[model samples]
Target: MTNLYRSRAMQDAEMSNSSFLPSLPSELLFHILSYLDIPDLLSISRTMHYLRTISLDPLLHTYRLQRASVILSRAIPSRPPLTELMARRVYITRTTLTALNLGRSLTMIRLKRQLERRPTVERLIELGVLPPECYLNQSNGISTTLGLYRRRKVVQKEKVRNFLAEWIGELSKRITRRMIDSSRSTRDASSL
Candidate 1:
């Protein structure tokens, strides 16, 4: 009886899940996708492999671009500028970093003291007073002399940050290119 009940529950769950995006025809799906703003379309696209392929289709983006621009135009113009965004991030990181001090070891305290004696190039970059390109010259010199474990941990942080920044820049470029192309199509559409 327990096995029979389990089978019935599994069947019901499967039946329920079978009804999502997979049920829609591609043409109809694309039409539905057209109504979404760019961000929403991106999120929905991740729901399925086919949806991802279809959402990235140029024709669909033409519609999404128009929708996103319209949505953005309607949003409040008083939203905070880039400086506020950076400050908020710094505030959050600062607060969380202080919270992280509870788990500190002696080596970690020593590292913090070492970091304090370095130049303030990273802080300048964070504040937007200096560009990220200038930050490349500011590595803490002690990582080279540290033990293997310490070196790995110290070096890993910088490596991960560089990798993340590169990928983030790539993502920004792709988004900008798509928006530019969409704006052109929008112009063509209006001219028609």
Candidate 2:
């Protein structure tokens, strides 16, 4: 009795599973499969014998190729040719790559030589190229490029702050003078 019951349950599960894709008409199924790429079609083919036959159909692949060729043919006329694009440096050929490497190497060599000949921070400070605040203190070790940059920034901020403070002081003095003159005028008018 238990064996018969288990067999009936298994049959019901199989029937439900088989009804899913196989229930669709073959033409509709092929239409849906047409949208899937090659890898996906292969995966679906592996899932069942019925799918394997449909997914592996040469007619479907031929149709897909034809569709892709039509798309390419439509697009090709709007774009430049490969040789023109290569000349414009849109595509890097072997010669272009070699020239690029050579240019990079030459730039690096020139930069290294310039760096070797560059003046020290102390010399730059003396020449007024860098601010005096960039000078090394006893507390700090050797001054770095970043340290010099920060010192110059601080000096600039201090100058701006001082200018703003002076402008505000002058503006307040003018406002006070105006208020005093306005009050005196009102008092004189009342006395008259």
Candidate 3:
């Protein structure tokens, strides 16, 4: 009789937990995700592959970009007319591109450091993100640096700003389009 009671209790526990395991709809998940702070979201995303994919939804990417822009706006110098594009270019490194977690903060520190430089043209050339032909003079020092190729992209502040503007604009547009498409699809599905 005790064995039978124990089995019955186990069955009841399973029944109670069954609905608890039901999958959350992606819409609800996204809503929840939006409410989470960036750090929390990043932590959750890094914990598992499934979550990482969800967090990387196109809309989420747009959200991250917007957040980065806000952070940049607050951090950059006010007087010199630093465009969002310029902030992005210097801040958005290869690693940061893949992960939104530390991208904006890291970019802020790097940008601040670069701005306090001696303000020379060579320093600018060294920091510029322009292609070799754009800023590097053929007879200049950067052209032949430590057994390097004749033409290499130099990342300067101005160049960085241009690159950031172009790349971020393209990305932002694509993300906007995706967001529009996703909403339309949801509306259609609900109406059906």
Score every model by TM-score: 0.30, 0.47, 0.24
Write one digit per residue (lDDT tens) for candidate 3, span 1-192: 999999999989977763432365767777667657778888978876667777778797677678778878897766354356557575456665767767777998899998876465555556774333444565555544422433233345568889999999999999999999999999999999
List model 2 lDDT by residue over 1-192, tens digit each. Answer: 999999999988877785578878988988888888999999999998999999989998888888889989999899998899998889899988999999999999999999999999789988999776667765767655656688778999999999999999999999999999999999999999
Task: Report the candidate with higher TM-score, 1 versus 2.
Answer: 2
Give the winner by TM-score.
2
Report the lDDT tens digits of candidate 1 across residue range 28-49. 9888989877799779777878
The alpha-carbon lDDT assigned to residue 67 of candidate 2 equals 80
lDDT of 1 at 17: 87
User: lDDT of model 2 at residue 59?
Assistant: 90
Clashes of each: 0, 0, 8
The weakest ten consecutive residues by lDDT in model 3 span: 146-155
Superior candidate under lDDT, 1 versus 2? 2
> Highest lDDT among the candidates is held by which one?
2
Candidate 1 matches the true fold with a TM-score of 0.30
In order, the Cα lDDT scores of the candidates are 0.78, 0.88, 0.70
